[model samples]
Target: MSARSEPNEPGARAPQSRTGGGGAGARKDPGWWGAPPAGKGGGGAGVPEQKAAGDPRTPKRLPPGGQRGGPPWMGAAMPAEKSMNFGPSARRLLGRLRPHRLQLVTIITLGVSSVAAAVVGPKILGRATDIIFTGVIGHQLPAGSTLDQAVAGARAAGNDNLADMLARMDVVPGVGIDFDALGRVLLLALGLYLAASLLSWWQGWLLNGVVQRTVLRLRADVEDKLNRLPLPYFDRQPRGELLSRVTNDIDNISQTLSQTLSQLLTSVLTVVGVLAMMFWISPVLALVALVAVPLSVIVTRLIAKRSQRRFIAQWRHTGELNGQIEEAYTGHELVKVFGRQREVEAAFAAKNEELFQASFGAQFISGIIMPAMMFVGNLSYVAIAVVGGLRVASGTMSLGDVQAFIQYSRQFTQPLTQVASMANLLQSGVASAERVFAVLDAEEQTPDRVASARVDGRVEFEHVSFRYKPDKPLIDDLSLVAEPGHTVAIVGPTGAGKTTLVNLIMRFYELDAGRITLDRQDISTMTRTELRGRIGMVLQDTWLFGGTIRDNIAYGRPGAGEEEILAAARATFVDRFVRSLPDGYDTVINEEGSNVSAGEKQLITIARAFLAEPSLLILDEATSSVDTRTEVLLQRAMAALRSDRTSFVIAHRLSTIRDADLILMMEHGRIVEQGTHEELLAAGGAYHDLYHSQFTAAASVDAEPEPAAR
Candidate 1:
């Protein structure tokens, strides 16, 4: 059956409109990351030019193309984001952090030292309490003079146990209490606290550096991985979500490291240190404190098990929301024109609500751990006071020891409570790390082979076959040849594998079967860099960075001279409008080229192609943006540009490609007809039908008289 014009009808991809690098996917009008940034060049009365990407704290950007943008507004429903298993994610994160082991060890050491000093202060304070009590009980020595000599006399007689006993007695038994001893013990306790504080601050400062360096390396890795990803990867994934992983997810990990790492180490150390001190003072009371441990652990486990899933869901929702925000923000103009703002807002609300719920649940559940822990801690405190009071009355334990044990018990539970509180946030960070690892673990593009010299433009597709998905073949056993310096026109309906060919030629996709060659050498054997360097393309859609007009044009040949840049701009008619602008070629084209028209963005791409000066050229609807007269001029300029280059022009307008030396009419991934325009028209096949259907319809429209004014 003869194919029909349906590329723009519905459910079809716009040509070469995927991905961008204009900083947040602003690559022409109506782009996602490459989506329409200004909303279809559309700003109806109610349509806003830009919508919020989401909360400012969570940064996101939409790339250009056909993807959706903007977050769910206030109340429409969207699916909740999904969660993943944590084991692999956690292990992957550990692997990334392993290189920083030296820094981590230093941090842990400082953390332990600081916590240990603090833990000992309570025990020292208890000695001050004992001194004060003894003075009130009249057990103080007379200026602490006599017991010192008795201790030395006992040691001289080789009675070490007697010396220890003599040291326990006051200087003059039954004299006054030791006020001087109490003051010294209290001062020592204060010193320990001050030292602990200093060490803690130093460790915090060091840990910050470690996190910064790790995340910096992580970002670099992600950027490199993006370039290595296959085109099909972008085709399937959302740019905003990927950006979330690269930016938000990494930041989450960074935040967790900075806030939770030192605290975690301190909490663990405090638990151990306090437990040891409690046992040293009185094992009976220490055992009472141990009672709270199991209860606290059981509560934390119950809450964390549930909170972990919610935290994972929360991060996932964040990425999903980011994707939607990128879509809505990029295409906000569309929402207004189509009267879908309410719908978009509803969607936004739904997504926002979902994120809110996930976050709330994770936090609320984790929040329970602290209070629950504190409750058990209070119970333990009561139990200790009761047990220690009985021991003190029985003379089995000293009053000072009981007081210190009580303090140690509180200190012990304090860290466990803190750790429980941090559990949810740490889980969130781990989940985010897992998301990042997914990108790092994705199948990278096949490494390029040996670099080759400049292409001669002789190309052949021999028995090639490919499919985006295994069940849906896009190209099958297709074969063709393009002689040096010859123009080839590829015409096909929507989904007829027209644009897919460009992807294949540029090595954006690998072939499932067969091979392509250039100048008798297989293209697959050459590095992608070598093959792409020799080829230049001006796609139907255009991409311009956030820079001056001159920068965008010279993107293909960054080292191009001013003279060369001007010549390319002049050739593409960009110089004409550029001169009209205030700054001429230096005028900045904002991201998405929102400051200019769509056609103008396309023309910039044409100028970029000219600057590249490659041996092979592919123009897919390259001149579609210009009017009749402008297109004629463009065609002339393109002809001059293609003088010695092998060119492939994929166009819907037969007139633009009438001069093509060979025309291949494609349908269902197969070439149904091949010949020059004159030959195809005479044969009255699919090509003939397409031409007449287009021209005759246009003629009839032109022939119709304008309706008479009322």
Candidate 2:
């Protein structure tokens, strides 16, 4: 169905109604409509006015069908501030629960059994009371006489009437109780209790298993989805919010489902079973007990509706607060440099307060449900006592029946309150489910049809036009070629689309208007795994896994032997550093190589790349972060690895790429200059200008004499 036709659609396009200010057929007010004043032709008016038929002073609006400032749907949807609720969130939650049908059945069964066992206890006690009072005492009374009269008759006659009556009763003579029958009933109750306990335990065990595994699977699914999601998805969502969906929200589901599913099932079953038994005991008392059910339900529903909205708001604010904190911490260096610590802290405090308010409101409403349910339960208990007592006193009902009814009444109300409490947890689970499903439902990245073949490392970019967003094209109709065994150095100012160029080569983003090929085969036709495996990269920002140095170096090929790892490290001059450490190649590195210097991290990354032994290598600012000495050593290492391989180097330092076979200087997403270093310097174009402007300054600084004389 179309979104506009959906009953609960959160967003819909509505036709705009033109108001009186300035529209077609209205007299054009120059000041109000951006048109010329009546006498002055053009002035401060908001709308353009039509000129007289032959007037030469007015300018034309445009051709008949010209492009407008924005898309037609710009004003179609309402602002997010006006949203009433998280629409479609509940429906998505239900979809997630659909897979757990069998679990649901088990939960329901255990709940029913537990509730039945609970109700049986009170009924058994009531029956025992009846047997003692009515069966034993009433049977001893003489016919057509009260207990008092019978007592008087027994006293006057003096013939053991009470003893005769007791003997006539069902009680066994010369025994304290009916051992066999009582044993059987007691054993039945015991069995019920044991079964209920086991069922409850198993229910918890299974639900926890389901919840943990489900959440684990969900997190994995989300991670996989993120790997396949279009870059645009990340562009629109905060990194921390997305992280929360996979981490915090999934945790919420695990907690709520694991803890509450069994309780909810048990409470619901108890309430139903107890009510049925109450009606069986006495219809009038049952009616009084039931009167509170609807009232409780109505109040619970009202509270739940409000609570759900508040919970959603709370979660959203929590995500926002987490995002802000993460952003502040991640950019702490910048924050400190700018002296914005107080500003960041104040912003955090504001967001935290908003989260606090939302959480307070949600919890407050949910908290009231339990107390309200208990109050209604108390009132029901009072009514049952007053009415049941009167019935017993008037001789219409026996004391035993009244006692049984009172016990059942308590049974009925307690579960109702329990059920109410369980609702809060269920709502939380639903809220989390909504967040999880939102990610799973997002549009996945498009698949490529390319199949890996024997690549000769010859790469081609053919008339390619690309963009991270349609409105902001990054690479515009540019083309290049890298012959096998050639090193192509891409030089550009920051944001000149240098990284984007190589990213396209790896098929991270598909071309908007052209194609990229390896060995004359379309890159898009190759499987992503096969394509990426053939390429090796050493980035400026290196990430090292938590493992031994040998493991990190040999990560690409897990089973690589000691000889291969050492060989790769030796090629990158990393072996010298490793041998110096106490543990040699066995030294453990912390996550992201926090234990090492930036230059060491770069060397490790290069070693990993060398270990891969790929046909194509991409060095993305590999020497940018290192000192001059480390850069020189890396340059020598890269020289040895570059032979017989197609390599693309994105670099800012001109000295590092002077020996490259080809150099392409980029500006504003286009290759404005291309040649060898010598050829580009001779051409005196953009590259020449950049080289003289940046490198010449550096050289002059180096040539400057120290102020030793002074």
Candidate 3:
């Protein structure tokens, strides 16, 4: 049965309208990365106009992440602003590590055991100090003097304080150093330190594994999320920004876990162990050291609070700057041809300056943390030293105990300082985590039905309505049917929704109202994978990855035989050009496929589609880049491929679709006329006018007089 148009459509004079860039006419509008049109306050939006190709000022397209713009990793560090809810984001980040809980527990145990062994070393050394000091004092006294005699001698000299201190010392008068006890004490201290070192090393190794595995899982989730997200979500976001989240933000999270997680655990453990030993040796001195805790906290919080905002700006600007630089470099030729180099540079300078200021502020503020912490620690040290000396002289504490207490005081404050210093990395990492989490939390495409049906060549759009924006309708209550084994050609003005029609058929976007079916079965009920698997598409934008020509062709059907690959190549005229190259079918396409001409690339894509042998085919300006001769050959090849299969061809050049079984002339998203090419021309409607306008223009170009020989 022949397709029919809606009855409400006008017979002549198509309406003037504009949709998004989906239409060919909308090509004049700003690109996705660009501002809106001029009338909507989009002019002079700092983006330059695209210039014509081959201008002398136009620069050659540079390879992405090539020497010209450094590697992608060297782009501004992809940082994010502070998370809106830091606590929840941090918890979520930690949750990523839950899978490695056993390893984490082992690491924590090692950290605690290491701290306990390390904290004991100082106390043991203090015991050795006591032995040396007691022997020295004893050696200075008279030979064979008794304890009572020493006390009497000090009393005779009116040194009662010395008498009391001497009474507390358990040293024999005139005895020299006890080498045996000192040796044992030194050996014990060394053993304790050695144990501590070994445990800490083991802890570090385990932590590294845990962190990597967690990050690996996180990266996988991000990759899966991107695949599941709807196409419209991608359209609304910047490509560079999305890339930053995937690469840079995930990297930051990994680094944060590696550097801070272990350190934080160890530092807290050290603080607890050291504090306990300090009180055990001298509670009075422990109290004195505790005085610094509140002060240090205040200093850290003040500096961190001020720097947090700067860190947020610093990372936010970093992502923005990276995006801008990427866009500018990608379109470097366009910027140069339009003489917008200065404008591009000026814009870059502004973003660069903002990044610099933010980085400087964040660093400058956070940098003050260590010094402030040291100041507080130093004050506590001085007080402990003075009070310890007085207590030792009064015989309330031994010189060995005082020495141990001072060492414990330093250890106690040092860990607190270390914790304070981690504030910067912690904040930056959490911010990055939030960005990654945002992607994971984004809405995904609707899930497929539990059961899927097979598709044949027939497809039908039933009372379909759709829109890009809520206020502006692109395709309204449109209905069409494509029977089995027929070619349906769609032709319209640029914004007449030609591309949108094909997109809807592919289910790239969902309908606001109505249903589409395949062989009388609703397409929405099938899994996307199953639905897309049955269709082969040759797009205008040819994409050839970095691989051999043979490999690229085989991509359509992963296990396709060599003979099948060659046959498809021959059918699409790809084999001829490929054979002339040095390597024939084995010729390698570069990463950007710059090694091939535009027409050759188009042929390669067509060959790939041919290899698929799909039930349905879609060719959207697939032959537009090729010369007239090549186009004619490709049409014949496509005709063979289209035999006994449904094909949808969207084209602007009228000559290519004259033999189509069905021709639909669309205007303002409605199908105003549908008939065979001859029928449409005979009706003298919108298609009639469009067909003459293109040929008339082409005829005038061909009729121009030849120029005189120079």
Q: Which candidate is the best by TM-score?
A: 3
- Residues 375-421, model 1: lDDT tens digits: 99889989999998877655576678888888887787777766776
After superposing candidate 2, which stretches have Cα over 4 Å from the reference?
1-107, 135-195, 330-340, 699-710
Give a tens-digit lDDT track for model 3, residues 1-710: 00111222111111111111000000011111011111111111122221111101111233355433432222333333444566888998998888888998899899888888888878898898889999998898888889889988998999988888888998889997999999999988888888887888899889899999999999998989988887666554544556656766677677667767876787788778888888888888888999999999899999988887776676567556655665566557677777777766766787789977887777678767878887898999999999999998988888888888888887777777766766777776787788788899999988888455766788899999988788888789999999998999999987788777777777777889999988998988988888888888887766676689999899888899999999999999998899899989888887556789999998998999899998889888889999999999999999999998899998888889988999999998999999999999999999999999998888999999999899
lDDT of predicted model 3: 0.75
Sorted by TM-score (best first), the order is 3, 1, 2
* Shift of residue 522 alpha carbon in model 3, Å: 1.1
**Candidate 1 local Cα displacement, residue 355, angstroms:** 1.8
> Residue 364 CA error for candidate 2 (Å)?
1.1
The per-residue C-alpha lDDT of model 1 at residue 89 equals: 72
How do the residues 221-248 of candidate 2 rate in per-residue lDDT, one tens digit apiece?
8878877776545545654455556666
Supply candidate 1's per-residue lDDT for 562: 95
Candidate order by lDDT, decreasing, is: 3, 1, 2
- Every model's TM-score: 0.84, 0.79, 0.87
Model 2 per-residue lDDT at 39: 14
